[model samples]
Structures are given as structure tokens and as C-alpha cells.
Target: MTTTPERTEPSTTAGERAMLEGWLEFHRETLERKCAGLTDEQLRTASVPPSDLSLLGLVRHMAEVERGWFRRTLAGEEAPPLYYDDADRDGDFHPAEEDTWEEARATWQAEITRARELAADRSLDDLAARTSRAGESYNLRWILTHMIEEYARHNGHADLLRECVDGSTGD
Candidate 1:
């Protein structure tokens, strides 16, 4: 029998930033755990036909999402995607392939690190410089919550994908 991957968040005594960050990190690790022990091929395995979604796709998408919100929007830097194309909006979820696990994971982790650094000193209320696609605005708090929502949604998908790939399942 295989052991379940451990995923833990800090205690409740943590501050607001720490709490938000903790939940975000928890979801991140939850997604990672779903992909744990899978091969490159397994990671690339898509769901039913007509859907290109996969574990690898989620990792890639979140990496770009993190970069877009934290680095570009929050930090006021020009940032392009690491695995997507403007001409192909869903490029993050498409063309999921093999032997790309290491690169994908590394990119995601790096984006996460940059996000933390960019958010460290800023208050949650600090507004993002980049306007939303709908021409709206957001703050660091919104970004953090958005990220949590994004991860939670994708982690649900990851749970399904992982279970389909192997019988493993957990919270």
C-alpha cells in the first residue's frame, strides 16, 4: 500500500497574512500531493475527450496565474506567460505532453517564491497596478483569495484526475 502525501497548514494563532498565506500554501501542496508519485506520462494524462485538462496543465496554468497576479499586476512588472500563447488563450491547458514535469514544477515553484516576495511587505489592501481584463482593479487581498479559489477548484479536478490515474485519494 502507498502512503498518503502529508499536507498541513499552520495553527490558528497566525496573523491574517499568515492565515491567508497558509491556506494558499495548503491548496498548493494539495495540488502537489495529487500529482505526487505520478510519472510524466501520468501527469500528462487528460480527462475524458473534448477536455485537455490534466494535472500538468493545472500546474502550468497556476504558475502563469501566479506570475500574472503577483509579479505583473502587483509588482508592476511586464510579465509574459511561461507556457502559453496570446493567440491560444487556453494554451496553458492544451498540448499537455510528457517529460515536462521537472520544468513545469520548477516554474510553478519559482512563481510561488516570487509571489511571496512581492507580497511580503505590501498590505493586503495595496492595489494591483495592472487592471483586470474587465477593466477593473484589485488588491493583494483579492489576489490572495483569488489564488486560493483557483487552487481549490483545480485541486478538486486534481483529485479526480489522480484517482482516475491511480486509486489514491485524500483531502
Candidate 2:
């Protein structure tokens, strides 16, 4: 059984960067904890009928999101989608039969590491190297906040999925 990473409680009064990063990390670990101890088949089980939102799919989706926001938009790299593309926009949410829990977890963790490295030296007000689809530039602060919000929203779905999988639930 794979063990879940420990989730630290974000400080109540940290600075802006610390608070944002802390909350983001907290949510990241929360997702991991929600998926912990499940078999690959279990992780891939679309327990929620009509939704097909498996835990492994969420992990894969987050990896693509991390790569898109940090590696592509923020750093201006030509990092293309890992699990999705023009023809399959929702590919990440539908894990292929070959997808494994271990691989998905590793990819998600790698993206998180790269995201931290990319954001380390930038100021909150630092503009991204690229602009949004609407041509508006996003600062580091916005990216961090958006990432946190993204994780928070998915974590809610994760909570329900985990319960459906094994009757396990908590923060």
C-alpha cells in the first residue's frame, strides 16, 4: 500500500507568498491523501456513475494543469499538453487503460516540483512570460491563487470520489 504524504496546516498569519504556497501544498497533499492506499484498479474506478471522474484522472488532469500554467504560460516554454491535445481536450479526465496510479502520481509530483522551481525567484508582481488567451498578462500572485483555487475545487470532488471508492473521508 502506498502511503500518503503528510499534509501540513498552513500558518494563519504567514506572508503572502508563504501563505499561498502553504495552502497550495496543503491542498496538494490533501488530494494525495484522498487517493492513498488504493490499488491502481481502485484508483481508476469511475465510482461516480455518469461522471467518470476517477482519482487517477484527477491526478493526471492536475499534472497537465501544472504544466500548462507554470511551464507554458508562466515560463513561456513550448510545453505541450501531456495527456490532452487539440483533438482530445478532456483526455486527462479520462485515463487510458495503460495509465497507472504510480505513474500518474509521479507525473503530478514532478509538475508540482517544477512549478515551485519556476516560481521561486519571481516576485508576486512579476508578470508571466506569456499572456492569457485574451491577451492579458497574469502575475505570479494570480497564478498562485488560481492554482490554490483549482486544487481546492478538485479536492472537493476528490473527497466524494474517495468516499465512494472505500467509504473513507476527511480533510
Worst 10 residues of 1 by lDDT: 92-101
Candidate 1 residue lDDT tens string, 1-171 = 445467797568998888899999999889888888888898898864567788998898999999998999988898877777778888888645543878889999999999999999999999998888898889999999999999999999898888888877877
- Runs in model 1 deviating more than 4 A are 1-6, 96-99
- Model 2: per-residue lDDT, tens digit, 48-116? 899989999999999998999999989998987888878889999888788998899999999999999
On the 0 to 100 scale, the lDDT of residue 95 in model 1 is 46
Q: For model 2, where is the 10-residue window of minimal lDDT? A: 1-10
Which is the leading candidate under TM-score? 2
State the number of backbone clashes in model 2. 0
Q: List the residue pairs that clash in candidate 1.
A: none
